[model samples]
Target chain A: MIDNTMNPFLIFISACLINNILLIKFLGLCSFFGLSSSIKNSVGMSLAVIFVTIMATVVSWIIFHLVLVPLNLVFLRTATFILTIATLVQIEEMFIKKYLPPLYKAMGIYLPLITTNCAILAVAFLNIDYNLNLLNSIAHGFGVGVGYTLAIILFAGLRERLMTAPIPKALQGYPVAFFLASLMSLAFLGFKGLFGL
Target chain B: MSKSNKPGISAPGTAAFLYGVLKGNPVLVLMIGLCPVLAVSTSIFNAVGMSIAVAFVLIGSNVIISLVRKRTPGEIRIPVFIIIISTFVTIVDYVIRAYSPELYRQLGVFIPLIVVNCIVIGRGEAFAYKNTVKLSFLDGIGTSIGFFIVLFVIGLLRQLFGKGELLGKVIFSKPALIMILPPGGFITIGVLMGILTYYNLKKSKV
Candidate 1:
């Protein structure tokens, strides 16, 4: 078990780099691959993931401690957390669409996708699993979002270049993308011993 | 390719079953539900456990959704499917915890994450909702088999190369430790996918 008493900054750094939710933990590959075809979509999706992951972490943390624990309903964690995330994504989508039209337009399509991103829900589960307090949970959540953004944006840049590269027809799309991700993940592996954590 | 069989119409059971196992493989083809595939496939045992758990949830949810499709409202079908899927996942979670503590530890959060696995929800939304319960059940089986096949092969490769062992039987003194790590998972899948694509392309040309 990870030490829950570790510094929040360390937690943030560890989450962002060492145990990156996407590259290391493999939490959110669907969107990682699906939305990474273009930088525009990657940025848009990253913003939405950042927003939803942090929000869902906060909400799930509160619900798990306050509602589920008190009611002795910890077994409902899976269902409740998913439902909470789905609902949060829905409400956030509507709120953005209604009041923040420009931002909504930027991330509208990605919002619905965030509901099933798994990273959001995984963050929620990690917060509880690691027994992190609210502050640490927030930090971890933000760190994961940042890590995802870093990986996807970099990958989008590579994929844009890949579009024009002469490649075999069979290995044109996803196969090549997976190879790219493999190299990126290999690079991220170098960050493992950072700070000796 | 039968002319009389239209695209909108669901395929027959045997075809549906074969489709997931071959043509429409969830991992290799549709490319959904990849998280668990790369994560728990470090060892053959973990892979088998995960496959069974996923099969349970996928089959349970697909069968239930097919049974309740007519009564379920279209606007809310997704949520209902999620609820049903989560219910099954929770059951699998507890069952594993009670039965095999080691696997329970290894799988950890991934067991719960099955609720959001695109393959489960994707199958629920795409196939089970429109098809009969029998077909959905077959699809669930076929898809799980597809998942199992890929996962087991990856696990076999990783275990053999990573630890110089298969099913805990050591075959060599030195192993490429990277084969069991995060990057190894990515690279293995990438190469396998590339090879499969190459084979398919070559066959088509022939």
Candidate 2:
């Protein structure tokens, strides 16, 4: 499954740019707008997304392949994915609180928010809907999360420095953010169509 | 959790409707659910279909959520919204698949993804719970229409220049590839937002 497939570099580029979950696909948007004000929080939020997405993908993959597929319960994908993600977030929250309290604090409210992050569930659905195997799913999840982190970090860095940048009267906070997202997405569009990896 | 800044609140209903259209703009101003917008807004027909589907679910969920608002616990309000939106989105998804397979193909996975759009949940939390059912319903339609109008405009303009046609025809010989790319979507929407804001500022001035 790993050796025989689409270009890994294309997967990375697609997740990061052409199929960007934020600017294009509109997944993980809550975190994009909420936690992007500071680089520290952006990193924390991105890390949290990475954790929830990877875990949720693995668990959901196991469930879908082991149980749902056999039962032909494909219609239940939405309900199942949502429940699995909520449960995953709860478990991760408890473990982090106990084993990594400082990191938990850094993530704080954003941790719980990951449960509602449609990106996690959306990626799982994409895996099944596209019928990718376990290895591909993991690679896809990792790539998307990294894509997410790249976007958040890029956005956070820009937004933080914007603290000193002058702006027009009405086009201050959100307008600037949206414009910046546009530019960043434009930059990412450059990565299209280079995948012989 | 709701920051109810209901100003002197005379006919807050109308104000809320207006807010969704411009002040709290879903696409341009708020920048929510842009994924489907940019992806589907290549043609007028696709945008119209997506808009109608979104409108149906948004209005349906808003009314349902408002009806259940009194019984819903605060701790679980969000989950409930999620479920309601998901259910409606699923229904739309299946119905679209069963009936309009062609449009379904065009919209692709985005139809099902309507569940995750922040605009729906945001509408539920911000307007549906606080207002009467009637107000909530109106607000939903108004906001959805506003969203639809914007998507339609963007789609129409893009198709016109990008493809040299309005819907799918090729009204002109030379089409602009820039209008079909990611950067094109951003530039068009950015300029549209600027113009809209300028008009908004002018109107508010009067």
Best by lDDT: 1
Candidate 2 local Cα displacement, residue B90, angstroms: 0.6
Per-residue lDDT tens digits for candidate 2, residues A53-152, read 8898899999999988899987666767777787778888889899999978877567777776768877888887778778778877887898899889
Scored by lDDT, model 2 comes in at 0.77
The C-alpha stretches of model 1 lying farther than 4 A from their native spots are B1-8
Which ten residues in a row are the worst by lDDT in model 1 chain B?
B1-10
Candidate 1 on B1-206: residue-level lDDT in tens? 00111124378888888877888788888888899999998999999999999999999999999999999999999799989999999999999999999999988899999999998998898889999999999999998999999999999998888889875678977999988988888888988898998998899899
Residue-by-residue lDDT tens digits, candidate 1, A1-197: 24477888889888888888888899899889888999999999999989998899899999999999999999999999999999999999889999999999888889888888888888899899899999999999999999999999999999999999999887888888988998888899889778877
TM-scores for chain A over all candidates: 0.97, 0.91
Pull out the clashing pairs in model 2: A24-B35
- Summed backbone clashes in each candidate are 0, 1
